[model samples]
Target: MQATRVLLELAGNVVLLLWGLHMVQSGLTRALGGDLRRILGAGLRNRWTAFLSGMGITMLLQSSTATGLMATGFTANGLVSLMPALAVMLGANVGSTLIVQVLAFDVTHVAPVLLLGGFLAFRRGGRTRSRDLGRVAIGLGLMLLSLHLLVATIAPAENAPMLRRMLGMLTADPVVAVLLAAILSWAAHSSVAAILLIASLAGGGVIGPEAAVAMVAGANLGSAINPIVEGPGGDGHNPAARRLPVGNLVNRIAGCLIVLPLLGPITAGLQTLSPDATRLAANFHLAFNLAMAALFIGPLPWFARVLTRLFPERVAVADPGMPLYLDRSALRVPHLAIANAAREALRMADAVDSMLRGALDVLHSDDRKRVQEIRRMDDVLDRLHDAIKHYLTQINVEDLDERDARRVSDVLTFTINLEHVGDIVDRNLMEAASKKIRRKLRFSTEGAAEIAGMLERLSETQRLAAAVFVSGDIRSARALMREKEVIRDLETSATEAHFARLRAGRTESVETSALHLDILRDLRRINAHLVAAAYPVLDQSGELLPSRLKHGATHG
Candidate 1:
């Protein structure tokens, strides 16, 4: 009856510990919000910065797995380089040891005070900081309370013949103990929980020094499971996604092998320095992670090469059906979502440019094959436009700041213009092709040359527009607007020349002239949208917009 009561108490303590860890992790994630991504994005400029960012983020969140997963997502999205992500993962491992250190301290007396303060703060406060503080207090209190419960329950178990026999069996084979610990930790999905269990057993004399050390090592190896499983795999065909999990697996497996042999000496040396078995186990956990990181840091570049060789990058298909910017997970971080939207807009610009080029190809050649290729290109642009619209609708659901809202608005407007560009190219140009194929409608020599030249200028302008949007270059934006005005003037002049040719009976088809005018109109509208897309970025940067210049406005 006493043993049954003790087991129940131990089980309750474990539940409290798990709940506290969950609350802390949840609160930290909510408090940091999208800032985590921005910090990581800006900080991954070099290997050292990435490492530091990883450690800082993990320390703040109290979860190395979260930091590593975020890094993996960024790498998969091509936002950060692979080497920097690996560096960050290494740093996260080091930072996660801080939790174990905190758990090792004797703070049971302060548990009630922490719980009371945390509950009060959580109930009264509305701000993120207050909530975060409450979470920290709750986590600390529960950890201490659990330790108290564990010590109380397991202290009596030390003298039990059955418990002693079980402990002896575990100690008889350290390898089996290590394997058992690893399996339990993996099953629990919480290394901290596993470590806490070891700490509690060691504190109550339920497990010996060597057994505790083995368990600690095993828990370290088990912690890698979450990262490997949660990594990118929906598109496993993508080489980078496959490499991420493989690299993490190799790192953990190598760390385990190196530590397995040293476990006996490590525990002995620590025990000689400090008689406290729990302290020795905690130190062993810290030393193992730090030592493994130091050992692997130098060989990271070589590891990256090996990962790349094992999973070479596959070529991305130029299929317009793929929406480059519309990753559902991106909504969790609004800044990344905005960046992705801008990238998609640039792609839309390119699609429009391709459609225009296809039209020009049809104008230049009477060949049926060239005309058919243009039709295919038009289909591609149409698909891209549909995708952009759907992506924008999804992104709209995320709570965006003022600047991001304006950017989203600009992208939506730009997509509409690009869609119209596709329409003109597909409808008007295809109609002309059909007429030429069926009725053998032909343009005079001057008409053909003039139309081809105008189409070439239009395609060049589209290319520049895409470049300006992608690079976020103010100079390029201004140049695009100026070139657009030139295209407008050239279209006007070309229309007059074609009218003269029609009046003098030099051209047989007035319909071709009208189609040329319609194409120019659509091109002008597309350029206007491109200019609008650049406006918000320029305005945000304090660059004068064309409207501001036209109004003769100056900031005070």
Candidate 2:
């Protein structure tokens, strides 16, 4: 019963530590999420930049695993190359050890002050920034307090006969000790928590310096395990994205393997720097990650190439089926998330473009099989449109600047328009073509030429809208807006000409009069949808007006 009570206390302390770490991670993510992404995205110029940025982000986040996950998502999306990403992970590994290093010192007295200050600041919040900063403060305070609790809880274990016996065995067999620590670290989901516990055990003199060093190595290796589980699945998942987590695991295991045999010498050497057992263990963690980072940072390109060979891209993977850049992990960073959404919007436009081309194909050939296939393409557009909408909505607009908010609105408007265009093709134009084919009706040669010309023009307009969406260039957007007026004029003239042909006693024109007019109306509406992508850009530049007509003044 006494042992059970003691174990319960230990469990509570560990839970407290984990909760504190969670608060810090969540707080920082909400407070400076966009800036963090911008920094990460902008810093990937080379391996050195990647490494430094990784370290900087990890220090701010206080979790290497989160940094690794974000980087993995980027790699999966092809935003950052594997070599630069690996360099950042190296830096993150080093940065993740900072918590343990800080804990080895005596800062327990500051916890109450931090807790009070954090609570007050959090209560005073007007936006997420202040609240998130308070959250970090509270988490850091809890961490320091938990460290004190951890040492006190473990100190009594030295007098327990059963616990003492277990420690004796772990000290005698470093391999067994490491495996035990590694498993616990993975289960706990926080290396900082595991390392803090080990450091406390060292402080209590329940474990020697050598065993603590071995345990620290195991803890670091286990740190990479979470990323492995979080990565893309083996099947129906992104091959490139899975590599970051796997590669991170590889780095940890390899570093531990090399250092395991040298534990006796390394621990002995580190002992000279500190007679305190806890500091010795902390130093070993800092040393091990730094060495591994320096050793692997340069060869990351070769490493990435090898990983790609191992997980080759699937030959069957096609566009319009999977999202190219709409990564949920990116939502924390509004800028990257918006950029990803824009790319996905472009992909949706391409799918719509294909459907338009198919409608044109059905005009001359009337291939039932091909028309059916093209009609099904709208399903892909519908799914992608929903996906892009959900992704953009996940971004916290309250956290965004005016510029970013405008960018997000642009993406939303563009996807909505693309979806509308897709519906017009599937329900309106495809049906018209099917009816004409079913009745064995042939359009007059002039009508055929006119419809074909209009279809070709619509396709060109779609291509321009796609470019404008991605580039957000003012000139291109204005051109797209102008093209809308051109499409309207063409539709009006085509309709008038159809009536003229009907009055001339052209049998083909009279026979297919309804289908020809219906097709022209739908095509004009589709053009209007495609041109909507430019409205945001044109509005922002003051080159376009909200309502294209004067309210008070009328034209004669």
Candidate 3:
């Protein structure tokens, strides 16, 4: 009964540690996620910078798995090259160990201070960023408290015969120790937590240094596995997308295989670095990764070439109308599901953009084929919007926090707007183009130029709307609204100019009068659909006016 109680307490402490780590990860992701993405994007220029960027981001996030996901997503999207992504993974490994280095010391005294300050900030802070930072502080405090409790619980069991016998077996066979730690770390989805537990046992003298070192190797291997299993491009359908995760796991496996045979020498060397068992285990974890980084960083380009050959990008023969990022597995994780939905939403925007560009071509060329093509593209948008709506609705709303819930609504709104934009291009503008083609009608030169100008601006607004959808920046959203005004002015001027042409009895204007006006109206309507993406963002920031009416003025 006593042993069972000890095991249960140990498990509970580990749970608390995992929870704290989760809070830290989720908070930092919300607070600095965009900045980190920009920083990571900028840093991927070369291997050295990519390595440092990966380490810095993982350190901030406190989860290399999260860093891996970001890196993998960038690779899958063609945003960055595989070589630099591999370098980032190496840096992330080193960064994850730095957290262990800090926690290896006795820092339990600051827990209450952190908890008190964090609680006050979370309750009293007005800004979202402040609240997120407060959450980070609270997570840090919980982590320290859990570690303190873990040590206190384990200290009394140091001499328990059952505990000693179990640990003795682990110390006797380092292979079993490594495998056990790997399983625990994988199940927890956190090497940081797993290693902390192992270190605590070593510090408590319940396990020897060799067993702890073996377990550290296992923890490293285990953490790398989660990304390949659960990340964005992890489905085997896209081998190119799995390159970064698989490469990262390869490094971990190599490091473990190399260290296992040299356990005695490695543990002895680690002991020389730190006399305390906990610090010794932590040092080994750091040194192992640093060595891996040194050995692998330079050959990343060549290693990338090898991985590419092994997992060449397959020609996508699948229907383009099918959803790309909406993995059913991600629905269990609300944030991941949100990200998947966002990516799929972007696809809708992409189709709309193509339709806008094609609309300009059809209006100028009177191409029958282009009109048919634009209509087909509208079908793609409808399918994507439907898929996104169904996928998002499948996510349990009870599982979403305020931020995640807001993200879902934003993605749905953006996709719906894009779908409407597609309708304007296909049903209105394309139909007008088809009428002109069928009747052998042409626009007056002045009217053609005006229609082209509006179409150009519509395309620009679509791009801005996409940017707003992804970044949610208030300034960008405001700028998108400004473009809406510009488009409205263009439409009004085009209407007046068309009236002037009609009054002058311009032959081409008289011939295609209705078609020219329809084109102008449809272009303006499409602009409105594109601009709808910004309204929600501006409203949330309190930058949007409730209405354009004067104060207390009634609308009949």
* Per-candidate TM-score against the hidden true structure: 0.65, 0.79, 0.78
- Stretches of candidate 2 off by over 4 Å are 77-81, 112-134, 155-172, 236-243, 298-320, 326-342, 364-370, 382-420, 444-506, 524-556
Question: Candidate 2: worst 10 consecutive residues by lDDT?
Answer: 547-556
Backbone clash total for model 2 is 0
Reference-based lDDT, each prediction: 0.71, 0.82, 0.86
Q: What tens-digit string does per-residue lDDT give for candidate 3 at 489-520?
A: 99999999999999999999999999888888
Query: Could you give candidate 1's per-residue lDDT for residues 1-556 as a string of tens digits?
Result: 5556666787788888877776666556555646886797787887788878887888776777667667776887787778888888877877777778877888789999999999888778777568667877887788788878787778888657676676668765778777778877777667777788887888778778888888887887787775555444545345556675577667777877776688778778988878887787778778877887788778878888888888777787666646655544455445455666667777777767766777777766666777667677667666777766666667534245445567677767767766667666667666666677666667767777777777787777777766765676766766665665676787788778777888887654465666556655665665565555556555666666555433322221
**Tens-digit lDDT track of model 2 for 1-556:** 5556667888899999988887888778767766887788888889899989998899898888778767776677677788888888998888888767987798999999989888887889776578779988999899888888988888888777677666768666888778878887999888878988888888788788878988888898888886666446444666666677778889888887887899889988998888888888888889989999988887888998998888776676476667767766556556667878888888888888898888889998988888788878888888888888888888876546556778888888888888889889889888888898899999999999889999999999999999888887877887787787788999988999999999999999999999999999999999988888787777676666566622321212
Q: What TM-score should be assigned to candidate 2?
A: 0.79
Q: For model 3, what is the C-alpha lDDT against the true structure?
A: 0.86
Q: Which candidate leads in lDDT?
A: 3
Can you list the residue pairs that collide in candidate 3? none
Q: How would the candidate models be sorted by TM-score, starting from the highest?
A: 2, 3, 1
Residue 100, model 1, lDDT: 81
